[model samples]
Target: MSASDHPAAIRLRQLSIRLGLGSAAFEAVQNVSLDIEPGQFVCLLGPSGCGKSTLLGALAGHLTPASGQALLDGERVAGPHPERGLVFQHHTLFPWKTVAQNVAFGLKMKGVDAATRQRQAEEFIDLVGLTGFARHYPGQLSGGMQQRVEIARVLINHPRVLLMDEPFGALDALTRLKMQELLLEIRERIRTTVLFVTHDIDEALLLADRVLIMSPRPGRIIEDLPVDLPRPRFAAAGSARFASLKQHCLALLRYDEPATSLPRLTPLGAPPAHQLQFAI
Candidate 1:
């Protein structure tokens, strides 16, 4: 039941979203308008506090738009739907639950039979390369492995649109690379509209079909750049074209920004709990 059959298209029309309450309230993203083709993998790349996650939250229905409209497949995205799966930087898996149980939670919530839920959960466990670890709890797995379980849980729902907010941002460098490769492999099998938020330019270049550059504070799409590299971009990433694109991205990110710090914004509008470091 993969969304490969018919992925969802996302459209935004003059969307504006504000964060905080009362005197602290301020626009996070402003007048954002864009159309993402069905099955397209688009990365929202920008500095911290640029509203990449805010816009993604709007699409995921975790946050409502202050103005304009957010639509998925021609319908309004007024609230959360199973078809729109959201993954965060950290795994929100229940520590008490086993991998299989966590992955099966969604199905169980939908009133699926236990036998059917177990079977489907097994399939996704194998899909994420965790075949023999079904009984393992979150505490037993590594950070990367826990994230894999989170991803399996999300994918088991067969989402038409996948919203990721720096899903691999917390992993070590080597682990992050492996996770990226794994993500590419998974996306090859399950076609869906992916809107990923990242501050790392290299990650954006390697994973996205197109990259959306956002501005600081009142974020807006300043640029929509396409990654024309071939798939399995390991080799392509070293080519001159990749370097050129990286340079352009650096310029865009570094343009006229002050040395002063800006707090990273989250989907929930709470103060940032962690700092984000940019990679050249």
Candidate 2:
């Protein structure tokens, strides 16, 4: 379907996930529903252990839900598929492998020929701006560089949906800022659909087109706020409007009152470029 015909690249229907069984059972997510439009950058923001990662995994098809359903292109998500690409908080690079090799590894398993894999790997490496480091091993690279390789590895696959779980969480403040810019640049160039998870509201504001806030535990979506801030939002956190939105999210987080009902997604007006508010 066309982008307008199918607004959301991914959609969830009454999704509830319960881990373990009987006495050991715990519901990680309950009655959560969301729609992530194609080419949109969405962020899942919540406190630690609030199941943001679990919700991402369920959307990425890594974890199954106890009830409800997750859909991509209107089809049920059966299991892990190449259609979705994931980059975890911790870089999961093989230290023994060179940067280029690690990036090429996925294509290699897919039976892509050697020359083609190498060419594709090189292209993605360049895309992540890690061209010269191709031959270097992960051990030889700095933490930021290692994460770049992780991003390159996932991007090389050309997946339709990208799931990033705090990809820059391990970096220092300065490095985190740099990575954020790089991500926006790459996303602009590639137009990839992204679902990013982070606890930092400022990071979410900078990178996402929409921010979904989750309640404390038994994680359920509390707010689906549309961020109408213009692109190149690098220093967005410092902007007055951004600060306002950040405070709003924090208030929702700190409020102990239970949400009587889940926030519903609806078509709403765009927030003025310099003034931010949740699009109702």
Candidate 3:
């Protein structure tokens, strides 16, 4: 592949993951491979049970792949590191800690001194528009505010890659839109490589440089599409191109019926629902 084909940020090669043991095992992801360019925003999108989040965890090293590899800058990923920050569906801030404290936790873990951590945390908190809430604990913040802190916390580390798993899934519609805009702003300034997971097609198109669509169970990549839409991604739900991409993704996500043979899902064992009652 040329440099344009694989710009060398994150790459997954024939990756597969299994959840359970023996006959009960389900292949959450199988023979999935993808490439993300440096400083790119890529979304892994699929239905609820399609294993998108599982792939995110594997890429972040929170879950081990049953086979294949997750690579960062062409190097194999073994486990979670300071270089990779993950934002989950839930706001993962420490309830007892203040916003600044939560944001500084990663630097502290890396043995960064108090002064440097405070400086770094302040910069990112401001970047995320949460400077005023630095002293407030998670309980004092609203859902959107809490997610902002989570974003600041991760970004403060200056991680080379960000793995986000439905970070806006819990927010109200307006808040979600605002968060998406903020994310675009952050990407513009920092050029961080992002791997985001979401079930919302519109959100994916709004934020991704490319959108990877995965199939049903034994989730494998079904489509790899670049979103060539013009950016400073405006919030026009009525835009013609946006509507077209959204419809295209919706069509891909809608399955006709349970696939009969259910491909072997190379590298992982079979799914848990194989012998039992199954629903797709």
Highest TM-score among the candidates is held by which one?
1
Tell me how many clashing residue pairs each candidate has: 0, 0, 4
Candidate 2 global lDDT: 0.84
In Å, residue 225's CA in model 1 sits off its true spot by: 0.3
Q: Which of 1 and 2 is ahead in lDDT?
A: 1
lDDT of each: 0.89, 0.84, 0.82
Task: Flag regions of model 2 displaced more than 4 Å.
Answer: 1-8, 260-280
Model 3 TM-score, 2 decimals? 0.87
CA RMSD (A), model 3: 8.6
lDDT of 3 by residue, 1-280 (tens): 0112222389899999999888999999999888888888899999889999999888788899989999999899999886788898898788999999999998899899999999878888899998788889999999999999998888777778888999999999999999999988887677778899999998998899899988887898887878867786675567865665676677667744444532212112323332221223
TM-score of 1: 0.91
Q: What is the lDDT of residue 64 in candidate 3?
A: 92
In the order shown, the candidates' Cα RMSDs to the true structure are 8.4, 5.0, 8.6
Model 1 regions lying over 4 Å from their true place: 257-280
- Measured against the true structure, the TM-scores of the candidates, in listed sequence, are 0.91, 0.89, 0.87
Q: Predict model 3's lDDT versus the native.
A: 0.82
Output the worst ten-in-a-row residue range by lDDT, candidate 2: 1-10
Task: Estimate the overall C-alpha local distance difference test score of candidate 1.
Answer: 0.89
